[model samples]
Target: MTERARLAVVGAGPAGLAAAIAASARGVHVTVIDSGADAGGQFYRQPADDLGARRPQALHHQWHTWERLRDGLRAHIAAGRITHLRDHHVWLVQRHLNGFTVHALLGPEQERPAEVLADAVLLATGGHEKVLPFPGWTLPGVVTAGGAQAMLKGALVLPGRIAVVAGTGPLLLPVATGLAAAGLEVAALVESADPKAFLRHGRAFAAQPAKLAEGAQYAAALLRHRVRTYARHTVVEAHGGTAHGGTADGDTAHGGEVRGGQARGGEVRGGERLEAVTVAALDADGRVRPGTERRIACDTLAVGHGMLPHTDLAETLGCRLDGLDVRVDDEQRTDVAGVWAAGETTGIGGAALSLAEGHIAGRSIAARLAGTEPDPRGWAAAARSRTRLRRFFAAVDAAYAPPARWTELITDETVVCRCEEVTGGAIREAVDELGAGDVRTVKLLTRAGMGWCQGRMCAAAVAGLAGCALAPSRRPFARPVPLGVLARAGEATGEPEDD
Candidate 1:
């Protein structure tokens, strides 16, 4: 048992960082916990401390916001008002009488269970890429767009010499451009969204012309790099066997690791690594439009559909969720007492919106805890910003909304969950023959989401393939916990509770 903090914020991303700063400034004893060794989350990932990465800002969009937050955090830490714990991967959070108890795996070397008790908790767990399976997605040299970006930012290494970035979101532009800027021979950018969606929501786009200009600048960069961008396109397969094969012929390691590949375009020769990938146009149903398939020689495949909020801790506390996302009021308070959420954990509004939301939530919580009436004025402007930005996000969502007929694209032999080797036919049988309408039921029958990954690798694909509502998975631990830690959680002599 440790001294209880006035407030605890999970995630070191923009939201949690800003919230901690605001709360501490208001005289609230705050603790910010995160998995990163530093304050920035995935958005502002920095290179390894020893790497001497001088131009870290070059890899991020809102560099100033990070600098401001980081400085504020340092000031607070020096003053002893805030306790910032980096590399503290929170595994479990439970609501107590007047507050909550948080369990975390602290530091890279320390394995002992570290617990933090708090009067209030704010969840800013952030989000991860949604993996929608394709025919050749299970191949070496393939990675999520964000994952590839992380490699460039954190390790200062490119996944390959020639990379093809394909996805349906605005993130693809930056990833492709960043790889190209790093001297990688970017083959092309394949987007699955119709460009007309911008026109459909012209007002929203007009409201954020800066975003449009940013996109335009990225386009100009792509042009300068001689990178071809194909809108309304997708990578059908990653073939290692032949230049024209429709299937990927290598090992698939999801979640950011590129197993193997070599450049194979122009001066880049392909021999023992990723040689080529098949790019194609998807019909309205998300299936490969037969004749649109074209072989594009490349060394790496970077792809992602979108992102989903990480809401397990909030869900475990029985906080009310709006659809799959945590339902937060204008002030970012969840239904559970002493709990709040902001940033991508609440919803996907990118880094800028996350900072604003975090500041609002922090201010609101600080005001209420100090026995003062919550004015929520600062948050009002932030809310408006969130609304405007979310509209653009909604437009993007609608544009890339995975086609309804994509479930039919999966062949009976195609593996739905690579971890378990569960096939499309098994999932279909679970749904059609076994009356499994929901994801849990399908998992129970087909064991698709029951593999080592615990469904992180295949949840989005399963949900989309089943045409069911995508829900945030609720588990006792945020990540894999040691058995000794579990035993330390409680007595080891008792039998496990029945499901």
Candidate 2:
């Protein structure tokens, strides 16, 4: 009997779960690793089983899809075709003469080492939110738009009684409406992108009527909640209330009463929690228009520019990158042999695109490992859906890009890097005074990207402030590793050679 190839899948998101199910159905022995407590990843994030919620599906949009993926995974696991390692944080993947070794930290403590050996590896690591900072962004009660949603979905908790959702992406729509539906008083949905941009991509937008309808549904929900929307606008600064003393109306020394949405007082204060956020209109060039500032009172601020692909593992394996995302062929195979990538790592398309890509990749991987060429006809429907979704999201990406001159909103004193507390003044000094040209030089000149996050939150902002193009950082390890794990890995299999 021919032995089935062992495949290791990183991530338990829609892409990873779908890929595992598809490959296992085709006789591939699969092991799925994820950092979360359960399957479903971030998109279909569910409440804890102990929550005993009556209607968990109310928090999700495409509930049926999640059920299918979840059930498929369970069936495969029961049949001994798949093994799921939950709460496994993969730090690195090293290619060896025999196969590949996936090194991961297990459990909440993340101190124990676990390794998976496989003849082939599939990366579905997903993406992270891009946080461009303004004044008071690091203040309490200021969470990313996704973070707010995750709290709602995973913990069944609202960020605050009153909230303001601001950013430039499709994510804002759901975050705002979801909060409102959950009984939070949503003050505003401030969007930085001009709505007129969609008109330019009308043809592309019209091609996907389903996407259009989905957006319309969100709009209807926002209308039902009476959520005020401000197009071509963005948050300039968030004002928090102090414990020392403030007016009954939440006014502080730094900020006074918001008259017509404009703060009439002095400088903004960073207190224990967020109280309000100042928003400003953007001009055609993406710069904040003069005298258009408004302050909306709110207890929480949920903000995010967009998402950035996680390419650390793929980059370490010498896979090609198309701009910021991993470059994959039609079968979702990377240029590197015995490797495949799909989902947000390929681009920032949503869940539908990810599922299609994952299914195709699984079919391709299963066939190739069995010494047969994958028939394109087998995955034709998925490929077609992938193409359509890619085109549709391309338009969405173009329409929702951050304002061209968003950097203008950052004052010299505003903290850009929250990890190291690096201010905008320090970044400017690195460029103008220190003569640093690129992000690397700026990081070296000022300890901007050297903090705990390793620049994941601040890299784009730093690059923008420095007037440089953003590039993928080739990190050897995806997550921080204990020195002991490194030493043990070296002892077990010798140190990995440089590519």
Please report the candidate that would top TM-score against the real structure: 2
lDDT of 2: 0.86
lDDT of model number 1? 0.77
* Segments in model 2 whose C-alpha atoms lie over 4 Å from true places: 1-5, 243-271, 490-498
Report the C-alpha displacement of residue 261, candidate 1, in angstroms. 14
Writing each residue's lDDT as its tens digit, candidate 1 over 340-418 gives 9999988787887788789888998999888787886656877778788877777666666544455665677778799
lDDT of 2 by residue, 1-499 (tens): 0122389999889899889999999999999989998898889887776756567787789999999999999999999999999889999988877778888898898888988878999999999999898888987778999998887777666666688999889999988988787777799999998888999999999999999999999999999999999999989889877743222222111111111332233433544667789999998888889899999998889999999999999999999999999999999999989899989999999999999999999999999889899998999999999999999999999999787888877889999988888899999999999898788898898899888899999999999999989999887789899999878873455555546
Error of 2 at 87 (Å): 0.5
Native RMSD of candidate 2 (Å): 6.4
Question: How accurate locally, in lDDT, is each candidate?
Answer: 0.77, 0.86
TM-score result, candidate 1? 0.89
Structural RMSD, model 1: 5.3
Worst 10 residues of 2 by lDDT: 250-259
- Each prediction's total of clashing residue pairs, residues at least 3 apart in sequence or on different chains, is 1, 3
User: Who wins the lDDT comparison?
Assistant: 2
lDDT at position 107, candidate 1: 78
